[model samples]
Target chain A: MQDVPELVAQAREGRPRAVARLISLVEGASPQLREVMAALAPLAGNAYVIGVTGSPGVGKSTSTSALVSAYRKAGKRVAVLAVDPSSPFSGGALLGDRVRMSEHASDPGVYIRSMATRGHLGGLAWAAPQAIRVLDAAGCDVILVETVGVGQSEVEIASQADTSVVLLAPGMGDGIQAAKAGILEIGDVYVVNKADRDGADATARELNHMLGLGESRGPGDWRPPIIKTVAARGEGIDEVVEALEKHRAWLEEHDALTRRRARRAAHEVETIAVTTLRERIGDLHGDRRLGALAERIVAGELDPYTAADELVAGLTDGA
Target chain B: MQDVPELVAQAREGRPRAVARLISLVEGASPQLREVMAALAPLAGNAYVIGVTGSPGVGKSTSTSALVSAYRKAGKRVAVLAVDPSSPFSGGALLGDRVRMSEHASDPGVYIRSMATRGHLGGLAWAAPQAIRVLDAAGCDVILVETVGVGQSEVEIASQADTSVVLLAPGMGDGIQAAKAGILEIGDVYVVNKADRDGADATARELNHMLGLGESRGPGDWRPPIIKTVAARGEGIDEVVEALEKHRAWLEEHDALTRRRARRAAHEVETIAVTTLRERIGDLHGDRRLGALAERIVAGELDPYTAADELVAGLTDGA
Candidate 1:
């Protein structure tokens, strides 16, 4: 159990073990999370975050591994957070994906971690940003947040990135599925992965059509680009990386990066605030006050609104 | 708009339109929600809540419709709340499912509504209970909450029910998929819908084995039964209904029903309290204080935890 300052100092010195330790603290919601966050606060905001998200079997892991290689080849320290919001059992379900990413496991400049909500309060909304900050502060020039599923949580996580890459596979009804999952609007770059498969061109064309159907942008606005990739063979990945770099350049040119980071920060703060208050409410359960109110609610003597009013008053008054 | 008392009275008298209006008010989080909840307080708690949850294409809608028919045969008023937590666009994605449910639309004894998170604070956790309270107060003898997708949100909603039924279709790797989705432990009953499909028996057997692998229960504990149904043709629905009734009886005999309801009430209250605090946080964003804090965070001058602390302090002080 190292002190927060020592752990953070080692992380800053490019120690992967130290970096992994800091992330573990944040991911587990360790009691010293506040100290760790405070120590890392001044060192964050340097890393470029790119979120890779899509449904299962879209080759998200393979694409992420390819991107890691691309970034590392250019001499940039990279980190990948393979987040699985769908799996409550955390690391177990993502074991196969981690094995897929094991090529980077031995690289000193690459860090890879898998995150699940683990039934935490505020779920991924509360945890992912903290982990991202840990990586950002650890001197990772680029952080890839690859999420497993295209549920609402995944969409929210993807939108937190400076640039989001939405992936699709051909012949899966993925164009309509992506639109239905609401990932169509959140992507800065779209990749029709497994390009060697049938209907790859159709998938790309349909995605192009869907992106065009979104709100029309001004001349200076960045249009999301669709790239086709056969990630397993590492084909067309350089183009994907090129698209990412272009999007990043556009963001910097437009000063949209700062605004996006601020929005992300605001969301993170709100999630933490709500989670803090929720913890207090959980404490009320231990003191029997919440239980008493719940009993009354079930007895038909009190409505939930009135019971909540009392609980909120208790929280504020105690504060 | 009609007055709250008039609406409650009409709902109590089994006026379907009045009941629908009341639910709409709660679902929308109308300003009059507090008044409506207060009015409906004494009339709730009589309905038996059963949660039906599974992945998409598992015949959840068909099974739900079948249950509605079986309950109607017993002359009990029934309501179904088809909740889709994954779809941010609410009613549009659920429109087809509603059409499939239109067979009961003309029946005065049946009420069906589709609900989505709609980007609401506290999400389905906040809205579902309030909606359920409205349905319970509206003279419905049974309320079925059918959720789309087998994600974390759906799992949470299912666990909130007094009797949760986890559904599966044969030959979809559904048993393992259900386990990965974390729905295995939440079910009070399991149904293998589309039982006419191949591997129905295998699916049931695998589910039974998986359920056995979980922590063993005592002889007095209620074992969740796996029922097979060809839901589209309304086969084996009577057995499903019987299983639900037997579970309910066991719950009452063990006094677990009261505990479950009280737990549900506690959760509802906590959600409301969190949501109320979150609305205050949202107000801070309007006042520019949150924006200022976010800017500082993005600048790496402050950590999100500290920002959240200050926000929470302001909330409590103002209260």
Candidate 2:
């Protein structure tokens, strides 16, 4: 493998292979990940990350492709990260997204990656943030993170973005499911894709009604606007892009963008620290300490809670 | 609040209200949880935990109700725990299940509780195991843990069970999705609910075919049997119980039961330890140490990886 700095430098210079390698390092938790993150640290925070999430079969991939085309037409660099954590087959859904996005495969101004978290520890909840950092440091003007909102981990995707778009389709029962999943709170923009289909208007109306049921939005609140789009045919792509830009302007003027990014950074830092602790726990698997504690719990000599407290105290005492 | 030992004694006497209060304490991460766990430790490991999981609308709740009735008829004390982590609206689905299970409400041999992961740290993955321990100590001969298998946390439910039953319905696209979600690997038994509906046999056949595709089971390995049931009408309920007993016997003969419980205990203990560490991290929220580290990362002076390492080191030093 090439040196971390060299790979990061090449990635920053818009080398697709290098970018791919950087992401692979992140996903695989390679030994050089620390060095790579350090090298990319100064170059980060340049990209505007937009999270696109919704239920399965909601045309998220198609919509993301349309948005990428629109952004490319506006003469800006773009990156697409399709994060699917539900499928045990890591790349199955991503391969489908890749076929749908083949038009931009050859575009030098666009970078597309799919992250399936089949075997990755901490899953996408841990990897996506770092991957976003990599893409941001690589100088992409706009980074789109597309994820299926069906899984719990997917909600974390929205928190990573500057503006989160929640997509819904007609007759999918996604409206109520989305509400129950608590996705309604994470979205900054609501999109009803496949709007050309029957019942699209009804879906939109239902979404609007649900949004209205919540505590009334104050003047200072950023009320998420619902939009309709036929992503397959590129219909309403311009309006969607306009909404994103307007949201961006709103964020900048209100200073929400900096705060959001800082919160995101804080979360990332905390996640890494906790993940390190988890790894340390794993290292104790073969050691006698953890095994003894578990045995004691199982033998009814110590409660799991007290044993857990003791274990934590023991692990941290040597620190 | 009552002391932990008294509460445990009350809960173990099959007092529903006491059980409810004990569970509430667990859900709230109450300060007395350690003492409660200690008091309950010796009383656990008696219940035969059966996990019932499937996609939504797959009749999981219906099947669970039927199974509870069957177990009760056999003179075994039964408890039902519906664990739903994906829904923020806690108890919504469980209310319906409670209605379906109303017949057992007045029976002293049956107890029911619904657990939602709303605001619960580590979600159901952390809470379900402890909840199972609580039920076990409550003198239940059989504990049914029902959960929706659509999200990542559902897999952990299977891990907690000695025997996991995966339910399916005809024409739900669940067969393939279940495989893709790797449910096939977790199931000890498979049930095709709504067998009176069309495509029930086809669903069973498809599942069998998929199971056949895996590395063939050896003579000593337990092969998951696919059975069809119309749980709404109480049809095939006896067969399901028979299958469960047969599987339980097989587990004992193969000495898999002890190994499974041991593994479950190990997982539960590890989860508690990790959760405790995470809480410690959360306590650092308002502290300047984490904020300072994030600031340095954002400013490009320190990489998140190195900063996380330093933070973990600092946190663990005085433990």
Candidate 3:
């Protein structure tokens, strides 16, 4: 392994390979992870985290690419973390993501990484925030976390970011489906991508109607605005960036930024603590405690709830 | 708080209200859950568990209704547990489901229950199996576990059943999407519903083509067959029943049924144990241990990994 101080120095200087290696260590949960995180901790909390999520075939990748381009043009160092918790293989989707963002691959100002939810103890919910910390500490001005907006993990990703952008496209019947998926609650800014399509106006109208239906945010509460974008052609890219900036400003003005970061830190700490406890329980597998409990449950000697209580009592001290 | 013995007896006699009460206890994780489960344990393993899952808007509820009708025609008692882990209100989807299945709602031999994933410690993966036990103990010859084929929870539902049926519709591009969601691997039988639609044949052809791409099962191993049905009009309903029976027989003949049940039990046990430990940690929230650990990590005095290790040690007796 490379020296932790030297790697931290290189990463802070915006060396792509050094940043990549640090993220790898974080993802792999290496023995030196503590030292690496300790070195990076002071430099963290500088970059703004933005999350982009939407249903599949919704042009999320294209929209994300346009945002990266817009940020680069503004002379900001940007990082992209493409998170796919469902797919284990990085071959198909990651390859597609790379091909879509190939234009910026050679640009040193942009760092792109694809992370799958394989082999992670706490799933993407845990791995993503740590990766965000790495990028934030590595001197990036902005970081984008893009995940497929399908399940609970997507919601978790949205909560991890400073600004959550929910992307949708026209003619996908996504407006109603989005409501069913709880997308309306998590999105800070809604994007109707593929605005050049036929039903783009209808989709945007429906979204506005639904947003109106939500219990109105109180006075001074930020109202999420809908924007239309033809991401494939790079149209409306500037408006999306501007909306992000406005949301950030709103978050700061309302003093919601500290509250959000505090909530995020609490979640991370809980996840790590819970994961560690589960590992200890996992180590008890071959031991007689869990096995005896399972036997009693299987044999109808006790219910699983009781067995679980007994097992927990065995693991913990009375206090 | 009825007497557990009397409630179990009433449940075993196929009393609708008694069955409903037991399932509610399971869903609530009530204090009496353990007693109820203990009473129901011996009566489980009698019902044939079938899981129906597919993308939304694919007529899953309709197909489930058709299956209930077909099973009733065969003089077998049926129980339907519509497990919707995503929705909380149970207002829209469950109401629609109740209306669709109203035909069987009044039948003495048919019991239908809707379960939402709200406020469960272990989520649907833990709740669904216990609910199945309640239905199984109620003397139902067949239990249908229906879930939307979207996320990890759906896959967990599939594994809990003896036979998993993957439902798809024509022209939804669901063939490719199902493969991406890992739905293809979990299904023991595939059904292309809405077979009267325009692209029914194309959908079936694509499913068959994808099935062919998989590695060959050994000789005498069961190969999942793709069947077509227009479930709304009851068209081809008999074929789905026949396919399910064939798969069940295949499982029984190969000793796979026991293996599947064992695997399900192991998963349930592990989930319960892990959840119990998490609850203990949740109880530790107000204690200064977690707060101190968080402060150390946040202040860069310790990495989260090491902090987690220390927190775990603080909980255990060094065993």
Fnat: each model in turn: 0.93, 0.74, 0.35
DockQ of 1: 0.61
For residues B1-319, what per-residue lDDT tens digits would candidate 2 score against the true structure? 6677887888788887788778877867888777777788988888999998888888887788889888988999888888874422234112334367768767877877777765856778888888888889988899998888876777787757999999999998778989877787898899999999999989998888888845676888888888899999999888889899999999999988877887777778788889888887888877788888877776778888887878788778645
Alpha-carbon local distance difference test for all models: 0.86, 0.82, 0.80
Which of the CAPRI classes, incorrect, acceptable, medium or high, describes model 2? Answer: medium
At residue B155, candidate 3 shows an lDDT of 76
The TM-score between candidate 2 and the true structure equals 0.81
Cand 1, B chain, TM? 0.91
Ranking by TM-score: 1, 2, 3
Poorest 10 consecutive residues of model 1 chain A by lDDT?
A87-96
lDDT per residue, candidate 2, A1-319, as tens digits?
A: 6688888888889888888889888778998888788888999987999999988888888898899999999999898888875422224112334467778867889888778764755778889998889989998999999888867778887766999999999888778989987788888889999999999999998999998845686787777888999999999889888888888998999998877877788888888888888887787777788777777666667778877777777778655
TM-score of each: 0.82, 0.81, 0.76
The candidates, ranked best first by DockQ, are 1, 2, 3
Could you give candidate 1's fraction of true interface contacts?
0.93
Best by lDDT: 1
Worst 10 residues of 3 chain A by lDDT: A87-96
Judging by DockQ, tell me the better candidate of 1 and 2.
1
lDDT of 2 at B282: 88
lDDT string for model 3 (A254-293, tens) is: 9887667655766687788787667666776677777666
The pairs that clash in candidate 1 are none
